[model samples]
Target: MKFTKETRNAGRGRRDLLSVAGAALATGLAGCSGALERDGDGNGNENEDGNDGDSDSGSDGDSTDAAELRETLAAADPYRMHQYGPSHVGNAGGAGPTSDVDAVWTFREGADDSHYEIGTPAVVDGTVYVPENHSVGDDGAETVVYALDGATGEIEWEWTYPRGTAFGSTVVAEGAVVLGLGGSVVALEADAGTERWRLERDFSDAVTVADGTVYAINTTYADPPTLVAIDLETGRERWTEPLADERMFWPTPPAVADGTVYQGGVELTALSTADGERLWSKDFGNAVTGPPTVTDDACYVPLGDGTVAALESDGTLRWRQSVERGGRGSGLHPVSSPAVADGTLYVTSAWRLTALDADDGAQRWTTETAGDRPPVVADGVVYASGLNVMEAYDGAEGDRLWRYETDASSSSGDKVAPVVGETAFFPSAGLHALRGADATSD
Candidate 1:
């Protein structure tokens, strides 16, 4: 899809201007409120000195001034993926907005066209990154990646590829944005839209990065599939391992935790992240729908037959539960991955959001909704997107808190999982920036 910059509305009233500024400031503060440091392993965590190693405020004090916090937040780009990490746990970690939310901005492209599709966006620093695909006459389709101001909905930079379509979500890692284009994995400079490097391969899923390495899957209809790893910094080939002898179709992205890379297709496969060696594999006799959610002790795989299997880290089966059994004869199972937070697993089946005990696979609660995208958890609340509304519920009890109507269609197959920072970011027809109704009052 080709995108041209649209003019920004300059007729906003004083109250609207203040609202945008306040939302931006809140987003900055929220980014700074977390542990922004990266340890020696490059995973984000506090340093041994009990301070955020990435903080520029230094060891002089724990409190940071507003100016320094804003700068730090803008540079950190906290929430950048679908579920906040490669595991697809969908937890935002810190506090998120709780009160009723109002739209701060809406960004749209080709507003009159109905044939274009927008992929899920990645939010970092203060910018929203989105990829759009549209058909081009009788030839192939085109894909365009865009960066928009998170607060104001203004385009910052956009790059179009004339030959390929980007169907998977984008990943932002180590100062660059990585995505799959046709038969290649391309990395672009996040700030300038300049090409860093491209690795040619038939990538079937989105790219996942961990400990400085990029992991992706390559598949063909009649050929064996392979799991390939590349160095994120240089885009150099690291290792490749044949996944299976049979044809693997629509492989889910690999989730790396500890030292194991978990991928699911016809079965669940675990491989060593060091050399792409297969450690273990299990056949559920059913196709695994989405990427497996990994934790320190267990791996959760969602199946196409409405069953969720919890396996031990070493590939032992813990338990399996059928959360949704073709609700009302619809014969639809969950295609979205499960999100884990506070010892609870959140998943969507048919038209309901179900929460289960992560350890024992026990049902906790279920709430009726209109859509089936995975749910996101932050600060003891779960945010889910229904047909045309986003709803927030208390995490522990599944009690509804508030719902905000949206203009975007939730049935587009482009799952809309809200990205939480100081405010909640939702993407549909366009991107929407929202803040809690009680934010200013608090």
Candidate 2:
């Protein structure tokens, strides 16, 4: 469903705005609240440090293995639900809007003379790419994607896509921005903000980018729906393949792994990334809305009716677990995609954050977040967000660690992720950064 300010009960008038802004500002300040107090050993050696090394090194391993794992997890673009990635890292991660104690950065559009509520923002390199729009539709209004310095939130450049809403969250690859809108895919220069190429095809589905390729699903009224791939550097069509069957609306992107792209249309299909050739497809008899998580052995797909299924790379069903019983509990719809870390698969239903055995699909534990954002796991902890709550859980046993409350109904976009850092960076709900408390003993 479309989002409307009028539908929100955040309250109206000046008082509400100030309350929201002040709270947001306070949260942003926490971004740079301070270093995580560490033991004098210099190694993240505190019992609490888990794999302790240094305050930074312990948790922030720049090792080849860790980096490769990070690259693999982010490989399929976990931010397929929101516009931005895990968190603005490097310079952008250190930028002022994010470098304070509890700093909060909100995603807004160009409204009135100064204010606007907008869609997701895409972070590329050291800049944050935001959209300024008048409305959403083919002839609704035009959208301009602006590249802002992550540190100063300064606009470095902007690219406008005529006749498109700039509504979907964007992905980056090979120094180019790939966005889905106006029934098409558009690419822009990372530095100059110039349009490099565009493919017009109405897409309500989100997209993912990897290894210089783009994958997106499109739903139409008359024509059958399709999943298309385009060259990252140029918007030229690499291939356009029909979804498992016609009339299926894929709201999410496809996952890429082991040289094959995994997407759940009417069925989950493993397509050869090199040429968009279908290697195999698996049907679960349930409609899937987002990208499946592909590991070395399995693909995790979340279905719309309230279930998640595991399939092998060859289109064979391994196991299936129901996300919600039959009736609607709290999460009216399970919009967030599944996130895998270590050996568990984290999934969000309308009412809970659940951990499942990656190998067997058995329940491990469940939290009460009914998350709309993908959960992030680090140091044996799992983080998730919902309408008004952000929570951290023990990854091993699913124990509640801590819970923070935001304003009522303040949720980030569907694609947002809990960015791991010395402090967890909550970029959604505008932009709030929560710092980790001093580490005690394990």
TM-score of each: 0.78, 0.68
lDDT of 2 by residue, 196-265 (tens): 8877656543577777777776544326666677777766678877664454343455677667877665
Show the lowest summed lDDT stretch of 10 residues, model 2: 88-97
TM-score for candidate 2, residues paired by index: 0.68
Q: After superposition, how far is residue 24 of candidate 2 from its true place, in Å?
A: 26
Question: In terms of TM-score, which candidate is strongest?
Answer: 1
- Superposed by TM-score, candidate 2 places the C-alpha of residue 309 at a distance from the truth, in angstroms, of 1.4
Cα-based lDDT at residue 34, candidate 2: 21
Candidate 1 lDDT, tens digit per residue, 1-442?
A: 1123321122223332332222222111111121222223322122354211011211123223223433433664266665777777788766666766655455554323334456667777867787766555554566778887655555788888765343556788788888866657888889988888988766653568888888887754326878889998899989998877865455666888888899777788999999998999999987777778988788999887777899988899999998853242134454457889989998876557788999899999987754456678887888876434566788889877766553332123335555555566655444555556543222
Alpha-carbon deviation at 186 in model 2, angstroms: 1.5
Global lDDT of each model?
Answer: 0.64, 0.50
Q: Report per-prediction Cα RMSD to one decimal.
A: 13.4, 11.7
